[model samples]
Target: MTNIHAPEVLISEVGPRDGLQSVKATMPTADKLRWIDALAAAGLREIEVASFVPAQLLPQMADAAQVVQHALRHTGVRVMALVPNLRGAQAALQAGAQKLTLPVSASPAHSMANVRKTPEAMVEEVKAVLRLRDEMAPGVPVEVGMSTAFGCTLQGLVPEDDVLRLAVLLAEAGVDEIGLSDTTGMGNPAQVSRLFKRMFQEIGPLTGAAHLHNTRGLGLANGLAAYEAGVRTFDSSLGGLGGCPYAPGASGNVVTEDLVVMFEAMGVSTGVDLHKLMAARAPLKAGLPGEPLYGMTPEAGLPKGWV
Candidate 1:
């Protein structure tokens, strides 16, 4: 096995899309742009800037196109957007998103509740989206996030077999990558390691980011487990915002600042400056005045004699 402590890791920031969308208040377009710029300036190479859902469905993301256009200005950062179907994919591509992520729930119940489509139906949707991508934007990559890859609140203990099967199906459907998401925050370190190891074995290099939530307070532990399993990319939100609306008691993605601190402290290079990354939270707060942000590193300053 490769050294678990490999020096470089990619911390893909999802705050602009996942974090903001969970809040009640809608962040202004200019403020969203400022937040994205700040995150990029802090060395985040990839950011999910927006989701191309209907404005009525998620008013917070009403400015998805505008946010994607502004995010494109940051040449060093890869602009990403979440798309539920082919129309959303087309909008994202038209808005110049460099990467697209589509969520496919592992639990059949959660799938219907969240996207109103069964898991198999979602796979077909991915195929259609990929076909559209081929016609409209050939080079841009589409990633399928297997949400509820862990146990689901609606349907307990999502069989590992189901998750792996969906992964294979998505890979067969022509996705650029398949990321595992603990959408319900019901995963442990052991489960994370085992699942990610199996994922790499089944899909090889198509394995992508580990999207873990802190709802059960094991976010960092699970992240470390994935790292040990040779997963290099991680998906986290600033201030630990966002959760699946379809999953009860699911809240808070792994906090970006905290994840960065953990990796950097372990001598793993994330290329993200801790102070700059934490400071980016200022713009986030400014955007949504009353929204709450969570991160232990920010609440408690860096340790003494620490570099």
Candidate 2:
């Protein structure tokens, strides 16, 4: 929502952070840099490049600072990193991340399992991160990706009232922007539209991206629904590459290349070069050999005369 009137939608690629963290193998630093450069060259304006978690917990993200440093060299792209707590946020800030995102799960069961904290406690952690951001990196935005915002695997059918309540708490807590995530990919189009409409009603312009997953094959459907409900930013991974290790049955995010095709073909400009974006998979595959990459567009190829 940086430029509300801009015709193009913002596709924030999260492959490096979300995708790599989900897999068993760690991508080498050099290959990660090359892959990021390829993505930037394809005209992705924003990317969640890394997560600042402990190396022991997620070794794939052990080189968080190094990746941030490399991604910063790309002039126009907004380099973002995920921070789990104030400590991670401090590391990200010191590493020169332009934007920081913290995941605050709405389901208490998911929250305790993932971060070992209650929903309310996670809010306090968010407040602490905000305070630290204000002290260390004053204008840099701190976004909260409300995980399991739609539903949870552990605690099924997360109440809508609970989701809205957390949104209000996050808004009042002073997060720069609050984005809803289908962390478990349990969201449907109608549910997505309804929740997003409620979110905008409650927080107005503070509502951010649609971080939907394709686990149920409704990622694009839910994304379109959110767009109709006024969400301009979308979070996707390069090869539909991410899932929460803590959230059972969670799998790939909405694919970036397919998303661009859907929006661009519908006359909604995404500002991403379709061919170049597709080519980014080269480095991805090179970096993580034998890892399966998913995307219908790549498998089926762009339709004849697709602009």
Candidate 3:
């Protein structure tokens, strides 16, 4: 068995894809590659490099194939990409992505608005991706992320049973792992603990992670809650760069720097260098000028004489 207390947690950076997609200005592909390389050098082993969505829908991801191809050349980094459906999966697989994440929203309204498919319909799509992975890229894991798993801006107070049901459905659909996302930043620490505990109890032994938003400023706390509930992998964007367009001003994913600092400070190793990780942000800032970068640790600075 993989030890639950494996010393440090795995923080998967989603800044390149999640962060860049939310902005109006698109970052150059070369700059994106440089940023990914820098993050890899900083000891970040997993990164959601880009999404394989159509260029017309998300121009920011126009060069996702190129980015994925480049990221594959890096050793020791698990390259992940988001695919809305089978077509994106094929593109990602052709580009050599080692892992693929498919989003299935728990909120009906959010689901329809985002992917134009209901949760159950999305599960069917997940099944299709799984089949394709088996036939084409055998052994490549397909992950189903339950967005709005905590709460939703469109359909508020998403039921726990609903989220768990979809997770079970995805597992039955043959996905390798399942993840819970607070896409609209509606999650709190107590809610996180309750939901994750129930999830593990009902769906024990399945790999799970927390993809939280700091919209309400409880991202790190929620992460700790899920971690205590046995979640080892965390999905965060460097500098907290994503947010729902429906909910203006709500920060998107949790900041990787803050998440890493929280764990490492508690004597839990993340295998990520704080200074080196922080340095990797320069390219991100340069790529998208005038965009606000969010984080507390980066501003407060590491404590003096503190190792």
Residue 199 error for model 1, in Å?
0.9
Give the clashing pairs for model 2: none
Q: Who is ahead in lDDT, 1 or 2?
A: 2
lDDT of each: 0.90, 0.92, 0.88
Model 1, 171-247: lDDT tens per residue? Answer: 98889999999987899999999999999999999999999999979999999999999999999999887765554
Q: Tell me the tens digit of each residue's lDDT in model 3 across 45-88.
A: 89999999999999999999999999988898999999999999
Task: Rate residue 278 of model 1 by lDDT.
Answer: 81
Quote each prediction's TM-score: 0.95, 0.96, 0.96
The true-versus-predicted C-alpha distance at residue 242 of model 3, in Å, is: 1.9
Model 3 lDDT, full chain set: 0.88
Judged by lDDT against the true structure, how good is candidate 1? 0.90
Look at candidate 1 and give me any clashing residue pairs: none
State the TM-score for model 1.
0.95
Misplaced by over 4 Å in model 3 are 1-7, 244-250
Please identify model 1 stretches exceeding 4 Å from their true place: 1-7, 243-250
Per-residue lDDT of 69 in model 1: 88
